[model samples]
Target: MHVYYYDENFMYMGEDIISEYDEMPENATDVRPKKGLYLPEYDADKREWFESASEEYIESLQPKPQPAADVTMLKKQVAMLTHQVAQLQRGGTS
Candidate 1:
């Protein structure tokens, strides 16, 4: 098992290779954070965030649902009207 060690401030320091039966380190806590939500990686230059593989896999499996057909038609109509209004403002024909 991978033993994740943290600093005094609870910031991730690094990891250790301890046997499964080995006692937990003083600076380390086996109480892992709850799953879900992006996890922050320890980076000195800049902080980085990462989504778990399971989350990514699930997201890939489910693509974003497209807007409803009526909504799409309405959007098209709004665009056409907006174009017509702009043309009128510029003293141009329809």
Candidate 2:
């Protein structure tokens, strides 16, 4: 559920509130026709609504997993390189 506010000139103030569940109207005016209810801001860019709504929805979504690092593989590679350098310093033939 989302609650929106607007000024007299039809300018959007922003979302007043957001909820996971839907909200029912209490009074007649709440259900009555108005200019700004659920209406997108007139001065807003075309992508603005899509972006903001998407972000809000995404924020309500679950978290994702993070990838692991290859620490052992890196250590092995470093050790192999160090051995190669030592052999080179000793003038050893490959």
Give TM per candidate: 0.33, 0.28
lDDT of 2 by residue, 1-94 (tens): 5554445543455543445464632210111223423433332233132122355565556475443457777788999999999999999947
lDDT of 1 by residue, 1-91 (tens): 6766656555665666788899888776554433553443333233332343466766777777877997899999999999999999999
Deviation in Å, model 2, residue 44 alpha carbon:
27
Give RMSD (Å) of candidate 2 vs. truth: 13.1
Cα error, residue 80 of model 2, in Å, equals 0.2
Question: Each model's C-alpha lDDT?
Answer: 0.62, 0.46
The per-candidate count of clashes, in order, stands at 0, 0
lDDT at residue 4 of model 1 (Cα atoms): 64
TM-score for candidate 2, residues paired by index: 0.28
Mark the regions of model 1 whose C-alpha exceeds 4 Å error after superposition.
Answer: 31-94
Q: For residue 34, give model 1's deviation from the true position in Å.
A: 7.5
